[model samples]
Target: MMMITTGRMLRCVSLVSMVIFAVLVNECSSQHTVWDPVHASIKNDIAQGVELNAWCKSKNTDFGHHRIAYGDEFVWTFKINFWNTTLYWCKMWWTDVDGKYTEGSYAIYKAERDWDECQNECHYSVRRDGIYQNNYASDVSDLVYPWPK
Candidate 1:
């Protein structure tokens, strides 16, 4: 029969205590660790010679208005907020080939909805019908918003 001596028990308790303390310290420090930045790209997929006007912003940052030519794209990168509440949205408009004006507003990224799906990168293709979205983690694209007729 193996009996634990008082000294042996004390040493084991000390080792366990040290491991718990180390784990706690690591958990606390991770809250302040810098997060990797997320990239967003918006591409124009309208008809040839058509230009898409886009203005995008977050609560604290605004990317000035841009005119994106067909086949061109506008891109930006930003780090997620410490609170994990980061969000970005855009207002877009363009004149169709028939001279009809179309416009829309959309939330391009919401941390709660995109954190798992986007996994750090988001892509948008603005088409004559709507906006299509693709993410870093998947090749599949989905139309998330449509232009207002």
Candidate 2:
């Protein structure tokens, strides 16, 4: 058996320790804001503080847990309910990064309801007063742009 040199062993330990330290630092330093803050801001910009509960949680997600996140786990599911009547699947969307605004996913069915009502229930609003800014996208058949492409 070959003898293990003290220096070699120390170097190995140091490398392992450094790796662990780096990992810990990364884990602690990785901070991500939930997509809600961005979405909420959009609604606020348009509606001036009007928002939906789901939207609010999405933008302000603590990722820390408590009432909304609850131990860093998401407590809410993404969905749209019109006065708890119709559950639409398609809606315009924007992101938290640079406020990149965009329409909803055409692949999904968007929920429908008045923007003011959605803001009232969820406590949110958009920048303008129209179908798109009304908390519900007007065009239900399409998400991004109208069809006929």
Candidate 3:
């Protein structure tokens, strides 16, 4: 006959509990953790008479070209890649008052760079002078890219 004393039973329980906890911790620390999607928006804050043309893309996605009117915005949502190297960039162009085309390319969402700065939502304001990123902490839009001549 096999017998288990109270102390022996308690030790078995403790060992089983420890193994379960270890498994849970391992799963939680794995690279397959569910990542929440991030939202990025670009608004045409240019002059009322002008329209902004933009084409945005990432390594895995292309948002296509779009013509945005004054005060309108283009928005996209995506999940950060498993390796955390996700990045999105845009090429933009618009006609100036002088009948010249101004163009530029800028990074919109870079996981490592924006993960802390954007806090899951990134906003950009485009103007004749430059493209600016909206800083939530200061309520200011800082220029990130300038219009190319």
Candidate 4:
């Protein structure tokens, strides 16, 4: 049987430690800072052009839009910076018959490392009877409704 030497054993340990260190560094660097744009679609059927606005609220930041026209189908995208596990709320609104903005619908998401848990696409429609529907999409799930009242 061959005898093991102390220097060789030490070198083997050093190599294993270095490999572990490299793997940790790679994992830390691979944590991505995602600036993802959420796609939104608004279908208007009130017989008039209505202003649309979409936004999201997070712990430290609120991001979204001001005033956009909802003609036929209003489509827009808003960007959000996702980094940690945070509760985010997204809301959309349109101008009513009295020219006042009303909260049409909203969605709440608990975002984790992957934003796939949250909604990546939002679809809203205003019926001729002044009713609205809120729909959202995700990778793991399909269209969901009535989120947390």
Candidate 5:
């Protein structure tokens, strides 16, 4: 009778330990699966044709220099999985009809709790006069570059 009771106690202890381990694992794994969507829209208004390029980056990772055309709109979506109080940015550059180049960018610093408040979409309009229609909260004065200049 003593041996049977000892065996039952060990089994119960093992079961409880397994349950605790499972809960810890679940919590850790769920944190990494939390991701938010970011949308970007670029509209080109430069005449005589132009090459529009844009990209997004977080930490040490970056995406691309996606190319679009004059009078065209390009839309992109990104799934951001990590945030260390670092800002995520999307930058744009273009070569205009006269071979002049212009650039602009937008960035957002999103906190974990603000994930649901993330901007569903951001719009940027690239024009020969300069970058226009910026929707970012940051100051974009540095992004303006008149094509003739």
Candidate 6:
């Protein structure tokens, strides 16, 4: 009768809806996840890591965790060959949700230094611009210092 037909129609609709829902769930489960973009860090090396001068904000690589290895002074040391290592950069600062950079107190306000110029100071420079490795002695290379603006 009418009641039997109504019940069968309802069952058919329920089965169809369940099949659609299951398919949707399976499709979503098989989809891949997306990654966010890399950002830079703001930190510096003064004496220790006073405020923040140099920083690196990047996506962590699958093979290695990202790190900004540097110091305010020369207190921090490099584990690898100093020339191939990250020894000169530190972190900088950003303000609010909008990402405005607020220069921090830790920064020496000094310019970015060439490898040679830094070598002349209390620190070690990986690539000596003017100095040559012949056997023993070397000459003082003209230094050109670069600062962050």
Q: Pick the candidate with the highest lDDT.
A: 1
Q: How many backbone clashes does candidate 3 have?
A: 0
Residue lDDT tens for model 5, 14-48: 99999999988977865333344656566777674
What is the lDDT for 148 in model 3? 70
**Candidate 2 residue-wise lDDT, 59-82, digit = tens:** 223223122211121123443332
Q: What is the C-alpha lDDT of each candidate?
A: 0.86, 0.32, 0.84, 0.54, 0.60, 0.31
Over 59-122, each residue of candidate 4 has an lDDT whose tens digit, in order, gives 6667666554555565655555444465556576666667765664444444452254335564
Candidate 4 residue runs with Cα over 4 Å from true position: 1-48, 71-83, 95-109, 117-141, 146-149
Highest TM-score model number: 1
Off by over 4 Å in 6: 1-75, 79-88, 94-113, 120-149
Off by over 4 Å in 5: 1-36, 79-86, 104-118, 133-149
Q: List the residue pairs that clash in candidate 4.
A: none
1-149: candidate 1 lDDT, tens digit per residue? 99999999999999999999998897786533227788889999988989999999999999999999999999999888888898999999999888999998989888778766666677889998999988545678788888776
Off by over 4 Å in 2: 27-90, 93-126, 129-149
TM-score of 6: 0.21
lDDT of 4 at 149: 20
**lDDT, model 1, position 6:** 100
RMSD of model 5 against the true structure: 9.4
- The weakest ten consecutive residues by lDDT in model 2 span 65-74
By TM-score, the better pick of 5 and 6 is: 5
How many residue pairs clash per model? 0, 29, 0, 0, 0, 30
Compose the digit string of candidate 3's lDDT tens values, residues 1-149: 99999999999999999999998997776533327778789999988878999999999899899999999999998899888899998999998667888888888778887776665668999998998987655777788787775
Instruction: Give the Å error, residue 21, model 2.
Output: 2.0
Q: Pick out the ten consecutive residues of candidate 6 with the lowest summed lDDT.
A: 128-137
